[model samples]
Target: MAKAVSDSAQMIARMAPVLDSQDYCFCHVADDHKFHAASVLATFREEEGLTLVLPLAQAQAAGLAGPAFRRITLQVHSALEGVGLTAAVAGALAEGGIACNVVAAFYHDHIFVPSAQARDALSILQRLSAAARR
Candidate 1:
C-alpha cells in the first residue's frame, strides 16, 4: 500500500531551501545515464560540456567543478510519485522559464535548479505550497 499525499502544497512547505550562489562543475560521466559512478566525483580536468551549478567552492573541494546548483530538499513522508512531483515542479519552473533537475533519495525529493534562478524557484515553490494549503 502507498501513503497518499494529502496536500501537495504543504509537502513543498516542509522542504528546506538550498541556496546556490556559485557555479558547480558537473559531468555526464560517460553518458551511461547514471550519476553514481565512482569517477563522477573525480576526474575533473577541464570544464567542457560540464553542467556548472554555482559558487564553485564546495564542488572544487570535492574535485568537482562549479558554481553549485541551488537545491531544495523536500521530505516526503510517503512514497513519492516522481512523475507527479517532477511534473508539478517542472511545470512551475517552466512557467518561470527556469530549468530544473530532480534527484530522489530514499526518504526525500531534491530539486536542482540553476544557481541564478534559485531564489525565484523558491518563491514559486512557496507559492505552490501556499496554494496547496488552500
Candidate 2:
C-alpha cells in the first residue's frame, strides 16, 4: 500500500493537485431511482434526500442540474488524521476569492471548485505547493 503523509508541510509541498477534465455537479438523487454506488463519484445521505456528485453529462442526461464544478485531486496520499492540509488549501483558495468544498477519503483529499474558477484554483494550489517546497 502507498504510504500516507501526516506532515502538514509535506502534504502541502507534495499535494500535486490535478484538475479533472470532466465537469460535475451536486444534485439530489431522484426519488424513484436506485443508483448503483459505483456509477456515481460520491454520495451523502441527508434528511432531505441523497446528494450525489455526478458527472455533468450524467446529471444532465438524468434531467438533474446544478452549478458546474471541477474536481482537483491532491495526489498526496494524506493520512486521515492529518491536520492543516485542508485548512491551508481552503485558506489559499479563499484568499483568491474561490469557494472550496472538500471531500476527504482514505487516500487523497479532493477539492471542488467552481467550473469557471477551476484553473484559478489549480494555480493557487500549485503556488501553495511550490511555496511549501521553498
Candidate 3:
C-alpha cells in the first residue's frame, strides 16, 4: 500500500495537479431529491441543505444556473494530518483573484475553480510544484 505524505514540502513538490476536462457546479438540494452517488462527485451536509458537486450538464438539466467550475486534482497521497498544502493552494489562487473550493478526499486533494480560470489555475499549481522542487 502507498504511504501518505504528511510533510508540507514533500506534499507540495509531489502534488501533480491534473485539470479535469468536465465542468462542474455546486447545487443545494434541501428537498427529497435523490442523487445517485455515482452521478455526483461529492456531497456535503450543511445547516441549510446538502451541497452537491455535480457535473455541469446534470446541474443544467436540473435548472441550476450557478457558477461553473473545473476540477484540479492534486495527485499526491496526502495524509489527513498533512499541513500547509490547502493553505498554500488557496493563497496562490487568491493572489490570482480566483476562488478555490477544496475537497480533501482520502487519497488526494481536489480543487474546484471557476471554469473560465481553469487553465490559469492549472498553471499556478504547476508553478507551485516546480517552485517546491527548487
Candidate 4:
C-alpha cells in the first residue's frame, strides 16, 4: 500500500537541518524586472515578490533590504501541513525570544531571523524535531 502523506518517514526526513551561520538578504524588485539575468546567482521569486540570499557584506554593499533580516533555510516536505508546521516552529522560537519570518515553497520552508539569533533558532528547531519524534 502507498504510504499516507502524514505517516511517511521519508517525507519527514526531507526536512533537512540547515546550519545558521550565514546571513542572507531578501530583495524585492519590480515584477517585470529582469534582475536575475543581470547576475549569475540564483534568485527565488513568488507571485508577491522576489527574495535573494547573499552574504551580509555583499547585501549591504549592494544596498539591498534592511539589515535587520536574518536568513535560515528549513528542510520540510512538500506534503507537510503548512500553518501547523510553521506555527509550531515559530512558537518554539518565540519561546526562546527569537523573531522569525518564514517563507514556504513547494518543497521546503525557509526562515529568516535576526542574524545574532540564528543559532538559538536552529537549536529550537532541533528540539522541535526531537519532540515530534517522541
Say which candidate scores most in TM-score. 3
Q: Which RMSD values do the candidates have, in order?
A: 6.4, 1.4, 1.1, 4.5
Across residues 1-134, which tens digit of lDDT does each residue of candidate 1 receive? 23545455545544544444434455433333334344332332334443433335644655556444667666554356534566677898899998987766656666778877888988887777666556
Whole-model lDDT per candidate = 0.59, 0.94, 0.93, 0.64
- Cα lDDT tens digits, model 3, 3-113, are 999999999999999999999999999856787779789999988889999998988998764899999999999998998999999999999999999999999999999
Residue 9 lDDT in candidate 3? 96
- The C-alpha stretches of model 2 lying farther than 4 A from their native spots are 30-32
Best by lDDT: 2
Of the two candidates 2 and 4, the one with more favorable lDDT, higher being better, is 2
By lDDT, the candidates rank as: 2, 3, 4, 1
Q: Write the per-residue lDDT of candidate 2 for residues 1-134, one digit (tens) a residue.
A: 67999999999999999999999999997556686667699988887888999998888887887999999999999999999999999999999999999999989999999999999999999999999999
Which model is ahead, 1 or 3, in terms of TM-score? Answer: 3
Residue 50 in model 4: shift from native, Å? 5.8
Q: After superposition, how far is residue 108 of candidate 4 from its true place, in Å?
A: 0.8
Ranking by TM-score: 3, 2, 4, 1
User: Model 4 scores what on Cα lDDT?
Assistant: 0.64
What is candidate 3's TM-score against the reference?
A: 0.96
